[model samples]
Target: METSFKIAFISGKLGDVDGVSLEVDKWIEVLTGAGHEVFTIAGLYTNPLQSISSDKQFSLEYLRFDSTLQHHYEKMMFPYLTKHPTHLTSGTRDIIVEEMMVHGKELSEDIFQIIQDNNIDVIIAQNTNAMPMTLLGGIAVYNLLSEYKVATIFHHHDFWWERSRFSQNRIEGLLNKIMPPSDIGSEHVVISSYSAHILSSIKRVIPTVIPNCENFGKAAVLDNYNSHFRSDLGFDKTDILFVQPTRIVPRKRIEDSVRLVGMYGRKYPEIKEKIKFIISLYQGDELDDSYIEVIKNLAKSEDVDLHLISDRVSSVRILNNNGERLYTSRDVLVNADLAIYMPKWEGFGNAFLEAVSCRVPVVVSTYLVYKTDIKSAGFDNLEVRDNYDDEGLLKIPESILIDMHQILNDSEKRIQMTDKNFEIGKREFGFKMLSEKLNTLLDSYSDEIRASRRRLQKSKKSYAV
Candidate 1:
C-alpha cells in the first residue's frame, strides 16, 4: 500500500504574518499537496479558516501567550519587563515550577485526546520547544511526547538563548529541560546551519537543516485585486515605493531603512516628495513601543516619508472587521519598487525570499545567517555591511545609494536584476526543495514506525509463550 501520514502542526499561534506562522503555512501547503492529511492546533488563529478546514483545526486557550496563566508566568520569569522584582526567589521559583507541572499535565491530557481522536501519525511542533513565549505549551508537549511514542519533528525557528530578554529568566532548569528536551524519540529540524551548529554544541544532538522556502512556481503578480494596493495606501503611480516587509522590531533594524531612505531623499531632492518608505507589517513578537517611537523620530529628522500600513495587511486578502480591504504581504511586495531588509539577525530571511519571489529588488544586510546560509546563493542584492556608526545607525555606503538610484530610475536595469534574483531564488529556495526534504523525512519515519511495530508484536508473542 502507498504510504501517507496524518500530520498535526502544533504551535502557540498560526495563520499569521510572523516568520514562524508564515513558514508553517508553506509546510502545510507542501504536506497537503503531497496527499498527507494535515491538521493545525494553535493557541490562536490570526486569520479566518482558509488553509485548513474548521473541523481539522484545534484551538487551546491555555496555549495562547496572553492566557491568564501564561501572562502571569511571563511577568514573573522576565521580571525586568515588569520592573518589580529583579529576580525570583528560590521558593517562588519552585512554586512556579510546581504549577507548570500541574498545568502541563492537564494540557498533555487534552493534547493526547486530540491525537487519539485524529489518529495523528506525526506531530510537527512549530517553535514550541525553541522559544519561551509559550512556556506551558512547551512543557505540555514535552510531557505528552515523553509519555507517548508519537513520531515528532521539533521545528525550531529561534531558540531562547538567541534572545537577550530570555537570558535573565528565573526558570533556567525548566527551560533547559522542556524548552527542548535533550532526549526525545523524535527528529529535530533547524532552519539554518548556524542553528544546527548551535543546537549540536548546546544539546549534543545533530539536526536537519531546512531553510525557509517560497512557491516560486506561483510568483506574485499585480492582479485586479492587488492593483489598487498603491492607491489605497495613498501613493500615486509615479511614486517610488520602498517596502520594509517585516515587523517594527529592533532586530529588523528598521532604523537602517529610514536612514537609507533619508539619504536617498537628500541625494535626489526632485523625487523626494514621490518617495514613500512603507513598513508593510505590524509590530510583533518583540514588544518594544520605544523602538516604534525611535523610528518615527529618525524618519522625521531625515525628512523621509514613512508610513505604517500594517493595519491594512494580513496573512490573507479579505475585509477586516472594520470592512477595510486587507492585503497580504505579497500584495504589498508585488507593487513595491524596492525592498529594504536590513536585519541585524534572522533565523532565515523569509521576507528576503518573499521579495525575491515577487521579483522585487532588495537592499539587504550581511547578517551572520545570511553570510553563512543565504548570501552564497548568488543573489544580486545591493549589499550593506552589518556595521553600525557612532550614532547607532547602520552605516550606508555611497555605492548603495548610487545603485539604489540607478535601480529605481532605470526600468530595464530593474527588470534585469529582479528577473535574475527570481531565477536564483527559485533555484535555491523553492517549494520543490521543501517537498523533496519532507519526502525523505516521512520515508525515514515510516521505516522507524514499522520496525517499532514489529518489535511490539514479537514481544507480545514471547510473552504469550
Candidate 2:
C-alpha cells in the first residue's frame, strides 16, 4: 500500500510574489497529487491554502512577512550593518529581543495546538526554518522541533550567509542556532549544491537537493484578456519586448539588463527603435531605493525604453479600483518576445524557467548555482558569463549581443532555440523531476513516518477518552 501522511507547510509569508512563496505552491501541488493531505500556515495569505490544499489552512498575522516580530528583527539586526551601530541603546536592544521571544513563544504554543488538534504527521518549514527574516517564527520552529516528535523537512531556499546585508548582524548566534537547528529529527532540503555544501561544512548536516521546478503541463496562453497588455504598457504591436521579469532590486543586476538592451540597440539601431525593455515585477522589500534612481538614469542615458509595470501584476488576478484587470507575470510573459534574467545572484530564477515554459528565449547569466547545477542542462538560450571587473561592471561578451540580434531578427532562430530549451527544461526541471525527488526523499523516511503514524495513533486514542 502507498503511504499517505498529513503534511503542514509552514512559512512566515505565503500566497505572495516572493520566490519562497511561489515555490511553496509547487511543492503543495506535487504533494497533493501524491495523495497526501497538505495544509498551509503563514503570517499572511491573501489566498488561503484551502484553494489548493486537501486539508484545513491556518494564517496568523504574526507569521507574515510584515509581522511585528520582523520589524523587531530589522530593528535588532540592521543597526550593526548600517552607519548607526549605536542606533538603539542597550536597553532598547534588549527590549527588541524580549519582544521576539514573547511573540515567538506565543507562536510556538499556537503551532503546538494546531498540531495536536489536527494530528499532522509531517511539518515542512518552507524557508521559515532557514531564514531569520522572521526572528520569532524561526524561534517558534526551533522550539517546536526540539520538543515535538514530528518528522519535519526544512526547504531552505536561501541562507543568511548568502546575502551581504545579513553578514554583520546582532543576532548571529541566535540566527545560527535556530534559523536552522542541528536537529537529527528533521531533514534539510536546499535548492543548490552550494547551499548543501554550506549546510554540510557549517552545521555538519547533509541535505537533499530539489531544484525549483515548473508545471510544464499547464501551457501559457495569450488570451484576448491580456491582448492589450502591450498597449497598456505604452508599446506598439510592432515593437520587440525585451522583458526583465524580476523584482527591481540591486542583486537582480537589472542595470545589466539595461546595458544589454542599450548595447543591443546601439549595435542594431533599426530594431532599437522598435525594442522596449519592460520590467514586469515589483521592487521587493529592498533595504535601499537608491538603486532605482541609478537604474532609471542609466536607462535614460542608454535611450532604452524601460517600462516599470509592477502595478499591473500580482500573485492573484484581481481588478484595481479602476476596474481594470490585474494580470499576472504569465500574462506579461506570453506577450513578450524575449526575457532578460541576468541576476548577479539568485536562489534560482523562476522567471527563467517561466520564460522557457512560455516558449520565450531568455538571456540567463551564469550565477554560481546555474553553473554548478543548471548550466549543463543543455538549454538553447543566450548565455552570459557572470564576469565582473574591478569597476563592478558586468563584462557582457560581444558574441552574446550578436546572438541576441540574430535570434531577435530571425523568427525561426527564436522558435527553434526556445523549443529546444523548453524541451530541456521540461525534461530536467519540470514537475515530474520534483515529484520523483520528493517521493524518494519521503520514502527514505519510512521508518520515521511509521513511528510518527504510531505516535499520532496513540494520541488519537487518548484524546477519545
Candidate achieving the largest lDDT: 1
The count of residue-pair clashes in candidate 2 stands at 2
Against the true structure, what is each candidate's TM-score? 0.95, 0.94
Residue 149 error for model 1, in Å?
2.5
lDDT of 1 by residue, 275-375 (tens): 99999998886888889999999999999999999999999889878777899999999999999999998999999999999999999999999999998
Which candidate comes out best when scored by TM-score? 1
The global Cα lDDT (0 to 1) of model 1 is 0.87
Q: Which residue pairs in candidate 2 collide? A: 43-63, 43-64
- Candidate 2 residue-wise lDDT, 223-318, digit = tens: 887887887767799989999888888999999999999999998887778988999888765556788899999999999898888888877777
